[model samples]
Every structure is written in structure tokens, then in C-alpha cells.
Target: MIIPEKFNAFRIHQLEDKQIHSGFEQITLDDLTDGEVVIKVAYSDINYKDALAATGKGRILRTFPLVGGIDLSGIVVSSIDGRFKTGDKVLVCGAQLSELYDGGYTEYARVKADSVVPLPKGLSLRDAMALGTAGYTAALAIQRMEDNGQIPERGPILVTGATGGVGSFAINMLSNIGYEVVAFTGKTEQADYLTSLGASKLINRHNIEMGSKPLESMQWGGAIDNLGGETLAWLIRTTSIWGNIASIGLAGGIKFDSTVMPFILRGVSLLGINSVEMPLSVRQQAWKRLATDLKPTKLHFIAPTTITFSELPSAFDAYIDGNVTGRTVVEINENL
Candidate 1:
């Protein structure tokens, strides 16, 4: 692969007045953050965090300017690292791209060798981006929960924010592994959609009355919580004895009032799932599972949208406005 002197990159910059301005610009290899591997980026995907960073909606970027996209899949253009070389297929997710480093929204991406995973068998570059961070996060959550002794025999798993990408993947992956999966979402109109993803039941979040008690009647055996305010507190109080609750998002709110009663009285475990900054081995293993048992049976259903790189700027608003579901992939170099 020939490295171009200048290539197109969607760069994010903060003006002196503190507003974010992002658009395509021709940049050189030296313009990107330092990394050992240079990739010919094939596909990138949109996440809520990407939307926030690009639009300055939520202050996701630590630096003034960077390329925006948390996940990517591509072929290596070059690597100083011994483990990777030119023409190697690889993917990167949750490695702080667009947060602390220039990310995947470009024709070329320079990334840390430790953050890259060789494209697993059975997943093409586009398929890898389709799964991206959302799928990886869901797999990490389930893996952690199961590590903490979660089992289908314990009881059905309740997935909160079930219509979102991570929640949707969690519901499907759990069901495919023999666990009874229940989806908790405010969008009851999408009942059929949730059910098709293997949700055995739907709990309308808007209709349910969460009691204001430290410990409510035990309902779920375990849960994967994407909302972190009142819903998390309720899940903590109502989870069955010895159940695990994997906390992944804070869309509801950052703070949640809760007591240690669930932990002490019921022996419940609250596991926090942080996909970023994981050990290289752990990150690789997650993608390995995503290629096999945890591979979503309804992958296309979960991430049905594919947009050209030119269409990337206009796409972030839907995610910011919360009008989008599943996932969307951005094709940067389709022929790669």
C-alpha cells in the first residue's frame, strides 16, 4: 500500500471561543498523534461518543483537535511493531481514539500497536466496524458477568436501554447462549423489533413503577444496565440473591442513590464495564468471542446503515438527538 503525502481526514478543532469546528481536511502522516502502526482505514462506525466529540455536544475530546471515531477496521499500511506488518487486516475499538488521540474518521489512521487486533476469522472489515465498540462492550459485560458466576439457571437476564446498540447486542448474545432475556426499553412500539432480537419479554420502562425502597422484591436474576440513575438503583434493590449487575453507561444520569444493602444482604455484585484501556490480551479475547459464540445472529439487523465517508458529517445529529438505533458504518476506503 502506498502512503499518500496528503489524505482526507475529518478533523475536529476547538476555536478560541471554545466552539467545535469539524470538517474534512487533507492531512499528512505527521499530523496525526504518534503511533507505531499506520492503517489504511477501510471502515469506521458512529457511536454516541463519536457524535458528542464531533459536534461538541458533550465534550468527548481531551485535546483541541483530533480525528473523530471510536472504532475502525482496516489493513495495515506499515508497522514498527514486531507483531504487525503491511497488508495485515486489523480492527481497533475503545482505545481512546477521538478522546485522547486522532481516531478512525480518516482515509488513514495511525494507532498504537497494542490497541490493534488482527481481524478475526469470519468477520470482514465492514462486519468488524458494524460490531465496533458497541458489540465489544456488550461482549465484555457478559464475559465479566459470567466470570462473576452468572448463569441461565440463576434466572432471566434483564437488559435495560434494550433498544440501543450495546443493549440490543447484549439481549441477543445472552439469548443465543440459552439464557432467558428480557428487554427493558421506553420504546414499546418497537416490541416486535426487540422480540426478534431474542428478547423473550419486554418491560416498558415508562410504565414500570420502580419502588423507592433500598431493597425491593427480587425480580431479575441478573441485569446489564445501560441507564445509570433511578433504574440502576431499582435494579440493585430488586436483583435476586447472588446476582450480577454490569454497569456500562450513564445515559440516565451520573449519580445514583443506593445503599450497600444489595451487596451485603443479597451478595449482589456490581461490575463496572470499561472497554477502554483494557489489557491487550483481554481486548483480543473479546473480539475473538465476538467472531464466534458472541457473534450477533442479527448483526445486519443491529447495524443496518452504511454511509459513504462523504456523508459522515450529517449523520452525527441523529445520534446526538437520540433518534437513532442500532449502528451505522462509515466506508472510508471501500475497495481496501
Candidate 2:
């Protein structure tokens, strides 16, 4: 295959007035930085962080005219490194892509060969992006929780922000792994969808809201929290003895008001999940789990929409507005 001299990208630029500009534009080979592998991007997926970078809401982008996508699955077009060669299917997510440099929101992505993962056996490229950073992060959280002594027999595991990408996949993966998952979401209307993903019980968001007292009745044995502020504090307060709460996101608020009582008295543990800057060895373990035991059986049911590259901008709006229900897959190179 002949690689093109220029390709299309969803570029984000910081303008002279200190504003953000993001949209699809043509870019050349000269635009990309040096890398050992040049991939023909097959598919990419949207994450909450990508939304922040695109909309200028979260200050996720550190440079201008940078392509803003955090997850990519594609085939290598060329490689200077011995680990991968031309035509090898690969995936890359959260090695600082779309932050300090251009990322996967393009027809082609040039990233260091060290950052890529050879696509795991038993998973398709489409399904890989369907899992994407969201699925991978969810996997990492559960793995950490299990490592810290969380188990299905301990009791129910609560998943906050259950309608979002990470939360949805968390519900599915945890349930598939034999844990009783309790999904917490403001969108109670999506209860059936959550149930189909194997949630044992669906709780309204108000249930976890900050209340007058700091501590509440003992509830879940473990939790995967995405909201991160008051909900996490509540998890710490309400979890069973020796329970674990893996905090995955800060979309609601960054800081939480809480004392150390939960930690000191109840022995509850808080695990922070970070997909970015994860070593490739750990990433491989996560992906292997994703392809096997932790793989969502009804992946398409969990993430139903697949959009063309042109529709990504509007999809970005829907994502920021909390209108997107599941993972939004963007097809960059259709042949894959």
C-alpha cells in the first residue's frame, strides 16, 4: 500500500484570542513528528478526556493544532522498528496521545513503536476500539480492586456514572467476572440498558448524593467510581469492612470534602485508575484480560453507535452534553 503524502485530521488549535478551534483539516507528512511506526488508522473512539480537549473545558491539550483522539486501532503502514512491520494490526491508547502531541483523530497516526500494542488474539480491530481506553481503564480498575482483595463473594460492587463509557463497561466486565454489580446513574431511564449489561440493581444518582451526615449505613463491598467527588466520599463511608473503591474519573468535581474516618476505622481502600502513562507490560495484561475473561459478551449492545469520520465533531458535542448513551466508534479507515 502506498502511504499518502497528506491526510485528514481532526485538529484542535489554540487561537490568538486564547480560544480553542477544533475541526477536520488536511495535513501533510511534514505535519507529523518523527516516529518509528506509521499506522493507517482504522478506528478511534471518544473518551471524556477527548471531549475536554476538543471543547476547551478541561485543559487537556497542551499544544495547538494537535489532533485530539485518545484511542486508536489500526494496521501499521510502515515501521522502522523490528517489533512491528508493515500490515501488522496494532492498538495504542493513553501514552500521552492527543496531549503533548498529535493523536489518533486522523487517517494516519505516527506514534513511537514502543507505544503500540500488537492487537491481542481473539479480538477484532472494531471490537478493540469498542473497548478502547474506556474498556481498558475499566479493566485496570477491576484488576486493581481484585489485587487489593475485592471479590464477588464479598458483596455487591457499585459502579458510579453508570451510563458513561467507563461506567458502562465496568458494569459489564464486573458482572461477567461474577461480581454483583450495582449501577448508579442519573439516567434511571436507561435502567433496562444497564440491566442488560448485567447490573444486579440500578440506583438513582440521588442515592449516592452528599447527605447531612458523613457516614451512612454499610452497603456495597466494593465500588468503581467515575463521578469522583461526593460519590467517592460516600463510597468510602458506606463500603463494607475491607471494601475497596477504585476512583476512575473527576468529571463531577475534583476535590471531595471528607475526613479520614473511612480509611482509619473501616479499612476501606481508594485506588486511583490512570490509563495514561501506563507501561506497555501492564497495558498488555489489561488487553489480554479484555480479550478473554473480562471481555464484554454483548459489546455491541453496550456500545451501539458507529459513526463516520465526518460525524465526529457533532458527536463530540453530544458527548460533552451527556447525550451519548454508549461508546461512539469513529471509522477513520473503512477497509479495516
Candidate 3:
């Protein structure tokens, strides 16, 4: 495993007019921000947030000319972090990569020692990237739900955005752990794919009418909602007594208009999952669970589609339009 002295990274530069232009650019090892370890990055994956950052649609980067990827997996070639050594395998997710810091879109990534996690034994590099932030969020959602008393024997668990990475993995993992999962998706065409991932039933996104009513009939025992706003509000209303709902993203919107009826009457718990600033112990625990108990048997069900660094600009458009499905991996450095 040879680490590149000079590497390629997808760099986003903001021009004077405040427009962002992103492309593949040559970068040197010395150009990366200082960190305790440098990884010979093998694979990186795109997330909805990554798409936003690349296009400058969101204020994803706190700085200019930043690398634009949120997740990475590979082997360590150098380490000042005593926990890691040369040739040791590892993967990093969250810990503000690509947000407040330079990140994984490059052939090499130098990250703070505290943010790195050793790759779990059973997972390959590809597997770790496949899980990436999406699967980690899914696990966090489920873990929160369980911590709040959700159980397989408690009727059905609903996973919104079912065709997307987080929802897809949530459905598969929840079902594999013995809970019946009902998936919600706008892509009706992906019905078979969702079912294959263990969704016991599918709800058309359009059919779940967003009413302003304070409460609705309790329909589900628990929910893992990636789309926030009205969908989350709706889920809260219809959740059974003592049910838990994990809110992970705002793909739908940021605001939620709901009343306290669900909480005060039904005792519904709305757990907010912040994958970015998770404690190191919890991060390690989640990855270990991803390698074991909460691991999805149909992990390849969310198989990644590879794209070169050069193709990112065009691929990003597709991502924002909700036209891309499953995970998309970028081949950063060569492996032989």
C-alpha cells in the first residue's frame, strides 16, 4: 500500500461572486491540514449532504477550497496516533470530516487521531464505505429507539426515505433484527427493491397526506425518519403509545409543525440523531455493531455504484434531483 506524495482531490473553490466551482485538482500531502495520521484512502462515498457541499447549495464547508466528501475507508500508511500503525486498516465517518475540516475526497486524508476508528474485523473496506454515514445513522436511529424502549414485539417499525441509503439500511437492519419494517418512499418503481431489503409493506410518499391535525390514529410502533418536517410530524401523531421515532435528516425541510399531543398523550419519544458530533465511544460501539449484531445481511442490497473523481460534478446534479439510488463510491487511489 503506497501512499501518494502528491494526490488528487475534489476541491471546491468559492469565487469572488460567491459561486462555488468544484473539480478534480492535484494536491500535495503537505497541503492537507495537519493531523496525527495519514490514510491511504481507497474508497469514498457520496451522501446527500456531500452533494449539497459540492454544489454550494448548503453552507457545508466552513472554509473555502475544502475537500468535499464526508466518508472514507482505507489503510493507514503513517500515524502519530499511537492507537494506529502503518498498514493498519481503518475507516472514518462523521467527526466533522468535509464539514469543518478537509476530508475524504482525496487519495489521502490526514485526520485527527480522535476522529478515526479501526475498521471492524468482519467488514471489508468496501463494506465500511457502503455503510458509510448513511448506515451509521441508521444504526444510531435504531440504537436510540431501543434505548427508548422500542422492541421487535411492538408491531411495525416505519422507515421513511426507504429507497435511499439511510432508509434502505434501516429497513434491512431493523427487519433482520426481528422487527417488521414498513418502508415509505416516493419511488414506487423501487417497490421490489425495497421488499427485497425486508420491507414488509410499502407506503407511497404521496399517499401519506400531511394534515394539520394535532393527532391521527396510532399506526406504528416506531419509526426511523430521514425526511423531517411534515413527515416527521405525521409520524409523531400516528405513533403508538410509548413509541420512539428517530429524526435523522431534513431532506424534506427543516421545520416541524406539531403539537404535544403525541408526547403528552401517547408518550411518543422524538429522538434527534446527530451523527456528526457523536462521542468516540459511541462511534466505536456503532461500528462494532455494524460489524456484528445490527449488521444487515443484505448489505450488498445497497451496493455502491462507482464514479471517478472527474465525474463528480455531473453526478452531483443527479444526486440533488433525487435521481440517484443506492450508494455511490468514488475510487480515489489505486489498489493492487
lDDT tens per residue, model 1, 259-307: 9999999999999999996998989999999999999999999999999
Q: What clash pairs does model 3 have? A: none
Order the numbered candidates by TM-score, best leading: 1, 2, 3
The sequence of per-residue lDDT tens digits that candidate 2 reaches over residues 1-336 is 687878899999999998998998989867976688999999998887898899988788777778989889999998989999899999998778888877999999989887899999999999999999899999999999988989888899999999888889999998888999999988999999999999999999865555645677889999999988777777888998889999988877898877787788888899989998788898999999999999998799877888999988887777777788888788998978
Every model's TM-score: 0.99, 0.96, 0.96
The residue pairs that clash in candidate 1, if any, are none
| Model 1 alpha-carbon drift over 4 Å, by segment | none
Give the per-residue Cα lDDT of candidate 1 at 283: 93
Rank order (by lDDT, best first): 1, 2, 3
Top model number, TM-score? 1
RMSD to true structure for each model, in Å: 0.7, 1.4, 1.5
Cα-based lDDT at residue 207, candidate 3: 79
Q: Per-residue alpha-carbon lDDT of model 3 for 61-132, expressed as tens digits?
A: 888878889999988989987899998989999878877778899888899989999999899888888899
